[model samples]
Target: MTEQGTVLMTYATARLSDADIEALGSELDRIRADVVASRGERDASYIHTVIKVQRGLEVGGRTLLLGSLLPPLWLAGTAMLSAAKILENMEIGHNVLHGQWDWMRDPEIHSTTWEWDLVTPAAAWKHTHNDLHHTWTNVVGRDRDIGYTIIRMSEDQAWRPWHLAQPAYNLLLAAVFEWGIALFDLELDDVVHGRKSKRELFDQVRAVLGKAIRQAAKDYVLFPLLSGPSAVPTLVANLTANVVRNVWAHTIIFCGHFPDGVEQFTVAEVDGETRGGWYLRQLLGSANIDGSRLLHVLSGNLSHQIEHHLFPDLPSNRYAEIAPQVRALCGRFALPYTTGPLYHQAASAWKRVFRMAFPSHPRPSHPRPSHPRREAAAVAPYAMA
Candidate 1:
């Protein structure tokens, strides 16, 4: 290992005995089968419940209003119960939206068609999330999610005045505008900044506009017409649910990859690296959060981020089952497995945000390019989070 906390090339090339590798592979397959079976059963019930509740609110508005001013706190608590429904939405709902669940029975369809029938248009999310952010992750030039006005992820970007003036305030801004940040990306960076081509920009613009119209129809027109004055409480319930859900979603996502130990590389660096090397860097650079089985399940097992990186095509439900094997592999190879509780990781990520927002010194030039073999050879193990 090198002084920079990167695993060395020797470690990367080290092979476990063939029997151990086969055993690990077999263990992963067994876990995948279990997850698929369990998830299939749970998700069918989950989808039915969501459909029933949404329909109940729509059809029996008066009865619902008379019985409870808002959704029963427990029902409405989908927002505040961050660990429960929000995680459920992320794990189960998201997979369903992606058509990753039972794709053989119902093949994966584009989000544009109503076949998916997501609460939100799955296409827009696929474009921003699966296509852009997941593909690029911490690459500032490409990943729209990380480049907030003041909380820039890349070290190459110049610090703004407001960023320098009030560091804590910027973080507060991030927390408050987390939902809006993605929208801003669609409008500003992706469109106005010319990051996207003209055709792609127009497509995104249409998607965003369509989503706004659908939301307005539901929140403003349909609900008010149905519930009269009682609609106020219903609106409140919906808004509260949205707030809770958004907060949970934002917090889980932000903490996963943005923590202190994660590195933000320049476009120049990323452009120069080989695909395999880049994948390895992403594995080394991202941090994972620790949580319970439900938490792991809900976050799409993204807390097992390293495994996810290593095997993106594999279902997330398989992550926890494969985690120990991956950890053992890391241990045998002396790779640092960076992980911690959610808040601890979040705090660390926030500090990095602060440093990016208010740099104490001028930014340095990009590092000179080096040979891949030499680069791999010079690597040191990352510190465990």
Candidate 2:
């Protein structure tokens, strides 16, 4: 068997009988149903409270920065701003744009209305991230998020000499992750491949530039200028905060998506996928961070990446509640529940980044498993989500 064939055969989903897969899907659906039924004031209050706290931090940070010439105030203000940006980007903006809070019927916090501090427009992010990424997850070719169309992420993806710099640029990418995501979300590669029109790309570019200008003006111009004698220090502080937020967001995201034991899929592997099969793929493809309640909140509950992938629109707060059940389900099914400390997971993900930067030699093959649904040629290799 080929290396690719071996991968398909060993995937946790491939060993399950059709009836077993159906049963797994049914149980997952039950979990979702229960969460949906229980969603109410508690969930609403959780999001509202987070939003208030984030705003207060931002306000306090900016107020302190007006006197940022004082080293102590600069340090305190910058730290608060960094924390505020992280909270907004990870907890509030991300989850809100995922429509996690839409069930509350509050237009003020609806996905359609919320704009993030990042350069990427919410609509563009929703299309690429919510529509394409969440649906496809770690499917190598279809999910542009595999490496954001830049870095080499999977052995299934062909490597280039340019990838040799991924280890270095990967660090730069982390520092400017919001910009990287904004560019990635534009789907420029799709335009090259004729999957997206140049005209569409042009319009998206305009939207990105508009958002970028506003974000730049706020953080760089308006706030700094408002500081008068402390303008330069305040400007430096704002820049530091944004970079800190970017690096932290990148770390949390990479830890969840690329860490050891997180599986990548081929389109062929997912062809004609059933509900249970989808659940299985998500479970295997996503790894979680083992952390406290604060860490969970800061990650927008994406520390529970498996549960988030399984039920993307469910309330973020409910992830912790459902996590034990999901882990138990994986245990019952004899599937891997990939979770570890943040440091370990982050290190594993970074190790993969460096490893994939080099050429990937084929692994020795194993006999193919007798999967009832392994239709390796049923779909085109580059099938879009």
Candidate 3:
């Protein structure tokens, strides 16, 4: 039987008792320990190989595009540069800064030192993503990643008329993801609402601008000028490459985190969560994309996002190795193991964006003692869509 099929069959028969749930946690821990213990030559070789391949593509592509007026060379060079950027940002930079391979003891690859290709500073990303987002997962008010503080992702969020344009802005955000992320790091929502001081926001904005200027110079100014006669073509090529990388990363990330079956939690659901409950929350909050080896690598193995969230510090390469086991655990527990092909998952997430743009049933929220009878505590009267 296929791995997913087996999981389904198991879930058909098993019910999760307290004993079974505790055992499930233990089994997951056992697997994590085993993977942790076995991180050695294989892991090191894998990361080094990816880095070499990415660098080679970047160099070869830029060289071919340099001082060349050939249309075919421009096409090939742009494609190569896109591939290189995607690999560098996703497979290398994202995972490295996740501290996945810190056990390798390589300072160059350590999370503390590595910066990504994107405009968002690595330190800011670690604070918002690693520290806040991961810790909060899908908790509505707690996780700023819900709609990235822009779009209303659920009914729990107080919707404003501006959300009517979210579908449009969502596309825009995908096109310019790096910029959106850099802005997100500044906590612009808080800044505008007086939650964060303007002075502090200004300092953060300066840091982002500094990084942006350096990156822009490297791609559009310094490298293009180095190409001499091909300066224009090279600059345009870099621009296209960056855009492609940004869109692909944004798509893959959305597929993993916001698809149809994925659940969003309220603060109450996660407020007092235990270790096992936290694991369960992560499982429910994440979805996975089914694809070939190439897709997995380009996605930085975030294709196995379920596994990644459960063990965020684990080497990303190890995710593929552990996915089946994780699926089986979900099956044994009779919990959902959400997986879909890339297109399907992407479509599902977008559908949510569109569906949520309109008003809907009241969302489940924790009752505040002061507002025990607030109307959101129960669904409003039904109406045709």
Q: Evaluated with lDDT, which candidate comes out highest?
A: 2
- Residues 1-385, candidate 3, lDDT per residue (tens digit)? 2333221111122334334545676777788899999999999999999999999999999998895478888999999999999999889998898889898889899999998788888988888988889989988888999899888887788877888888999998998998888888888878778888989888888889999999999998988999998999999999999899889988998887789778777765444344555677788889999999999999999999999999998998899999999998887777888899999999998988887788777564533212123243333211111
Each candidate's TM vs. the true structure? 0.69, 0.92, 0.89
Worst 10 residues of 1 by lDDT: 109-118
Q: Write the per-residue lDDT of candidate 1 for residues 1-385, one digit (tens) a residue.
A: 3325332222122323323433444544454465556666554555445445544543443345333345573253323333333544566455554445443354332223322212334566665666666667666566666644446655656667666544565445444443464365464554566656889767766866677677667644665456665566656654555465565565666776777666555555454344444444455556788989766865766777766755554555656667787677557644467789988987876676667765555346444433333253433321111
Candidate order by decreasing lDDT = 2, 3, 1
Residue pairs with colliding backbones in model 2 are: none
lDDT of 2 by residue, 59-166 (tens): 999999999999999999999999999999988988999999899989989999999999999999999888899878898889888888888888878889999999
Q: Pick the candidate with the highest TM-score.
A: 2
State residue 312's C-alpha deviation in candidate 1, in Å.
Answer: 3.0
Per-candidate local distance difference test: 0.55, 0.87, 0.82
User: Candidate 3 at 381: error in angstroms?
Assistant: 40
RMSD of 1: 7.6
Using TM-score, rank the candidates from best to worst.
2, 3, 1
What's model 3's TM-score?
0.89
